[model samples]
Target: MNPAVKSLADRIEALLPQTQCTKCGFNGCRPYAEAMASGEAPCNRCPPGGAEGIVRLAAVLGAEPLPLDPERGSEQPRAVARIDESLCIGCTLCIQACPVDAIAGAAKQMHTVIPDWCTGCDLCVAPCPVDCIDMVPVTGERTGWAAWSQAQADAAHARFLARNARLVREREENDARLAAKAAAKLAAVQAEAPENDAERAAQERKRAIIQAAIERARQKQQAAQPRNTENVSAAVQAQIDAAEARRARAGLTRPGSDQNANTDPEEK
Candidate 1:
């Protein structure tokens, strides 16, 4: 995304309802905004935004206003998902489907929606295996931007972004743990002294296997990590520098560093 298109997409995303609903044929409002800014999608596909939203988008893009696309969906009064607790059967499908994390419950426990946080996206309705969720209209006849507030949209977007960040952090942490384990195993293999040529050959093979595992784990962790290096805070950078310095002084390679470096098995 070039600077100009990204700027346009940012403006477009700000105007979106931030429902994170897939009704627009995109995963979320930001992706839809990017598509629109790139001229790959029209501004009328968002039923939550309705006719008024199309006007706002047109004003931003200097394009003609379009009516909300009927094929995508019809604009209706805002609603919230309500789970029939008696019928819930503790499946938690609705919780998984909700983009805003509005549904609260665990597996084998009844799920309930926090009405205040619900975006009325209807995403959770279809995923319930027990057919216990219902969309209850909350905003009478008001629809689109009229029914939704800028504060609400901002809040929803914040929660969506936070959820994504947490998931990424969790995955990266898991990968790091696996990488640490593999590195430990590699160290253990290297510490095993060979008593004969055959034992030396077997130890070498084991070392090779452990090194490969560590490499794979490191690659996965690297891929899972966010690529926002430019946004690192000064304090965080200082901490990282200190940690690297410590590693250098300790005569121990970083977990992912020098996986294939040769050293005597008993050097430690």
Candidate 2:
């Protein structure tokens, strides 16, 4: 985006509810604001902003104020998620689904919502298997921007960004660990000397499989590494292509090559 457009998007984003909710048909408020700044999305998609929010957005964009799009959702009092501990099944699906890290618990353990942290995005409700989660209205009779504040929105946006960064870091760490283990296994296998041609072929096959796994893990880790820009370097792309070819070859190896080699001719 150009500087002017980016500035406009910043302003538009600042005026949003920062719910990180997907109700606007976009991934989050930032994306929706960018779309509006670029004229891709209309200003009335945010139900959290309600009519007043639409007016604010329209004033910013020099467009006529429009009513909230009912297709997105109707404006309602500010709400927060509540988990019924009695009915809770201890699944962590809600925790993973929460965009702002509002839900807290472990696998096979009852989860609780941190009301202060919750943006009431209604993101966690759908993922609950036991249907223990509920959206309880907090600001009764106060809906839309009237029920929300800029400070709350800013805090929610910060938490949403932090959660995303943490998830990426966790994934990259896991991929690194997997790649390390595969590399160690490959080295150990290579250290052993085959007694004969059959054993040598089997060892080679095992090494190939391990190498392919390591390559995949490396690629995954690289992709998980957050960057300001995208696109793999030419050298890295070439390495990936080579690894893919090796993986394909490993898959195409005769299914029973090792067994066939070991079996006696009479048994065959």
Candidate 3:
């Protein structure tokens, strides 16, 4: 690549979301940038970049009127990536899919999205079998993009430390809450507990008696039920035969079945 073209490509890439969603019908932002610079690819290929990106590119390149390529996708509201911790198998598929390397985690480790780095490409959402990833808009008091970006970077850096200052504060607060809850729970349990040793022994004896009664009742119920092993076995065998016949009709044979029906085992 020529230095001039490379410089132009870098500028174009800077304007892109870097999500690497490939909505542009190219491999990634760099390829799309190169194509656009060479006039082979249009400026409207990016959906995540939206109208803002189009307008910016147009202004830079002094291009004529062009519509956002509908074939690429539509410009939706800005969204941040979120992972449903419950469904996430931590396969690191999303991590690999992220163009910017916005997702962080090892295989089988819980992955988190860096909101600032996430381009809201929706690329990671599809490859997930568990459907755990979701895109959510930034709500509450709105902060400008520059500030948000800085804050996101700071957060990412903080995560590298053994104990982040912000996390330590949060942990302290959570620990206080948990400690209070534990104390309350202990009090409640103590109140409900038998008052004296004799009372505790009596309660244990009653529990034992109730458990024995329940066991006896279960045993009696089992004895009363008629066992029909022959009938059960016959039903199971019928199902197996039906399945085998279906497979045979479909040109699949059971193991050790005659490969050549014309050559009989009796002849051998």
> How much lDDT does each candidate structure score?
0.76, 0.76, 0.58
Top candidate on TM-score is 2
Better of 1 and 2 by lDDT: 2
Model 3 segments more than 4 A misplaced: 139-268
Mind giving the per-residue lDDT tens digits that candidate 2 earns over 30-51?
7898899999999999989888
Which lDDT tens digits does candidate 3 get at residues 15-57? 7655556789987666788888877887887776666678878
Off by more than 4 A, model 1: 192-210, 225-268
Give the range where candidate 3 is weakest over 10 consecutive residues by summed lDDT: 253-262
lDDT of 1 at 35: 96
lDDT of 1 by residue, 1-268 (tens): 8999988988898899989988999988988999999999998999999889999999999999988888999988889988889998876667667776677676676667878879999999997888888899899989999999988887677556544554455566655666666778888988999999999999999999888777766676666654222234465455445534543574422121112232223333
What TM-score goes with each of the models?
Answer: 0.76, 0.82, 0.49
RMSD of each: 10.6, 13.6, 27.5
